[model samples]
Target: MTILDARESGLANGGPSFSLGNRLLRAVWIPVWRLGAGWTPRQLHPWRRFLLRAFGARMAPGSDVRASAKVWYPANLEMHEGAIIGPGVNVYSMGKITVGRKALVSQGVHLCAGTHDFDTPLFQLEAKPITIGAHAWIAAEAFLGPGARIGEGAVVGARAVAFGELEPWTVYSGNPARAIRQRRRFADDASNS
Candidate 1:
């Protein structure tokens, strides 16, 4: 329950969250993915998609992953059609991450599905899934923490950190990502005008 208790339990008993084979797979695939998939031309989406898919990612056609974006584990990632992961995005998907259709993850965004339990001496790994719903927008420099969910048409403003679920058609901002306003559906705008 406490750090002291964890220390008394012994570090030898505590182990990595994943298997050795999984670690080895990442060791081999990371460099290759960085070199090949991360430096390719923006137009070469299929090639990049192929690389991700080969490593077990589920991505639909027309989903754009920028060259500079980093995915920690492709096996835990899923992107639906028209999803866009912009430049400098880091997806640390230790657990499942699903991006719905037409979702936009802007530049410098970090989607982190893993963290360490600070209460323990060994710092046991804690992981949870992240979901970005259809037409949701995670703006530049935003951070989506473990178990965060951005609902359909929601927008997370620049530099915000989402640690909980966002409501559909809402706009969020600030460090902990508070709801600031309701988002209007773009499709309804033309009719409203």
Candidate 2:
């Protein structure tokens, strides 16, 4: 993923992090989403998907996002077929956030694609894309930092904090998540598992 430096992008020096048009769209989207799908029942995935897609999210057929999930920028999100973003998940898509086919992000997970550059005096913002590979399972309340790549079929345990790349078919747990064990690889039936 390409990192976007706010200082180089002209967003530092007291400038706003986002362009005017982007802000305006978000302003309009906030209430639209709140009233349109936020109050819907959990079973109304299609309605929620429609609202997200209207804001430019690339949601494949069978991809599901819960009504309570908060997406910072729908335009920066992409969900492959059968991908699920569970209730109360926060998708802070300052950059792009891609959920691969059948990937499941559990409740209250934070997928943050933006952070501040602490070394810089100005504390400039930096954004990098996050990718969750196919069949990956992120357990409840986990935190994924900017540029995190959860490999295919990997499982991140509940409340874990993860950054960087995780190996495919691995089980990770704890703060600054470490691989706990190798998961059994499933062949073409990821949905069933």
List, residue by residue over 93-153, the lDDT tens digit for candidate 2.
Answer: 9889999999999999999999988887867678888999999999999999999999999
- For model 1 the TM-score comes to 0.88
Q: Could you give candidate 1's per-residue lDDT for residues 140-173 as a string of tens digits?
A: 9999999898888899999999987899889999
Score residue 113 of candidate 2 by CA lDDT. 96
- In the predicted model 2, the residue pairs found to clash are none
Hey, what RMSD does candidate 1 come out at? 5.3
State model 2's lDDT: 0.89
TM-score of each: 0.88, 0.93
lDDT of each candidate versus the true structure: 0.84, 0.89
Candidate maximizing TM-score: 2
Best by lDDT: 2
Which 10-residue window in model 2 sums to the lowest lDDT? Answer: 1-10
